[model samples]
Target: MNNADSASQSVQTMYAERFATDLTDNRAEQKELTAQIERLRDRLEQLRTDETWLTGMQAALPGETAPPRPRRAPRTGRKPAETDAPAGTAVPGPRPAGRAKARPSRARTSVKKAVPTAAAPLHQLIRALMPLGEPRLVREVHADLAKAHPERGTSVQVVRNTLETLVKRGVVGKGIQKGTAMYTATAPAASEGDEAPAAG
Candidate 1:
């Protein structure tokens, strides 16, 4: 009976040792799996970051091959006026009180006069024929002007350019017919004297 009890005790001890060995192996496997999962997550995060950076760099380059950049609205602020003065001309600083106002130098004044001279003839011709309702082709206007003033000898191209100038100045209306542009004189605003009396 004593031998049998000792044998049973030894078998129970061996079973406990085998159970402990299995628990340790399972713990090591769980740790290795957790480490592999963490490494995969880190790699995925790095790939996402690299992809985002690459997409941004592709947008900045020009042409159709690259992704389009976000379009910004055009600036609406007034542009600085260009001066007619020569490149090296020094702009005068503000004068002190009681100092004589600096007269515009001859060159500057002549440059101003020259600009008006180029535009004066065109303005005069358009103004003389104000409020014309009929749409006139550039060729017709040129022919009429040449016949009326044989000395001027203005070319058809010059007349077309003048008509375009009038359109820009809001003195004439321009329209397209079969892809060819036609111009009609726009009437001026009626003054108080020109207005009709109100009916009772």
Candidate 2:
């Protein structure tokens, strides 16, 4: 009877040890699965962020062709001859034989000042009508311009001319509807508030 009792106690102990070992193994597997899940989540987040950045870059650099380079000013120092000057006025005689002609200085004119005729009023009009999603008819534009510049009371012809000029300068786009034309704003106005470049 004493031997049988001792054998039963040893079996119970072995069973408890086996149960403990199985529980420990299960916990280790759970921890490994949790780590793998976290790593996968991190990779998904990284991929989403990368996709967003790629989309922005694609928007910023649309179209296959690169932007055209700005034209450089001519290197010749000669000032344009004053063709409109009256014939009688004593044009300054060429520098005396011994004195060297002074080199013409390069003046850095602000873009706004350079395009004064086209930029200021046009910019004002654009600011007044921002986020212009739809095309505006010539008559409607003229009316808006007149309302904004009541003191000037601009004519339809003038507004049309300005719109055409804006189109040529790439500041505005023209849309045709029913054999008629409409205008739409392009880029933001310049910081110095100049008018858009004039059409030839």
Candidate 3:
């Protein structure tokens, strides 16, 4: 009975050591996985930051659209032996014919239609519409121009573009409203050079 009891005690001690070894190994592996997770998280954050920066820069470019991808040229210059030469003995290809002299292309000159200019140009008319310190939209100016000069033909787009030009020239002040430009005269807008007809 004494020998049996000693044998059982030794077996229990050996099992306990094995359990402790397994527990330690498991903890070490868990720590390694945790560190790897942290590294992956940091790398993912960096990639996201780079993507945002690239997007902003791409939008800022003058040409907003993405550049067209270049197509890969076919391997026409050096074909494979399978196609280049048939199973029969290689026959030399016929000599290339002499290249024809390239004819000089005739330059076509299109006749541009003459654009009718108003007695007073549209820029001057648009400037006349903007009173100093009073901001107006393109549509408003176009309306005013029509009322003031019934004969002159002007569109909203034309007026808007003219206002932008004036803004660049420091003749007008530009503002934004509802994603559209509003313009105001910065200085004396138009010269009153054209004398009004004397009232009866």
**What TM-score would every model get versus the actual structure?**
0.33, 0.35, 0.36
Best-matching candidate per TM-score = 3
Clashing pairs in 3: none
Residue lDDT tens for model 2, 1-200? 99999999999999999999999999988985675566556656644443433332332342411111111111222212321232334332222111211211121133223244333465456434533556888778766655554333344566678777777767678889899997887756453255543422
Error of 1 at 95 (Å): 56
Q: How many backbone clashes does candidate 1 have?
A: 0
Q: State in Å the error of residue 125, model 1.
A: 2.0
For 1-200, candidate 1 gives per-residue lDDT tens digits of 99999999999999999999999999988985675566556656644443443333343233322212121111211111211221233331111111212322553465465445333454455445444677878767765665544434355666777777667766678999998888887755232123222210
* Model 3 per-residue lDDT tens digits across residues 148-200: 75445455566778777777767788999889778888878554324222210
Indicate the worst ten consecutive residues by lDDT in candidate 3.
Answer: 95-104
TM-score of 3: 0.36
Ranking 1 against 3 by TM-score, winner? 3
Q: Model 1 lDDT vs. the true structure?
A: 0.51
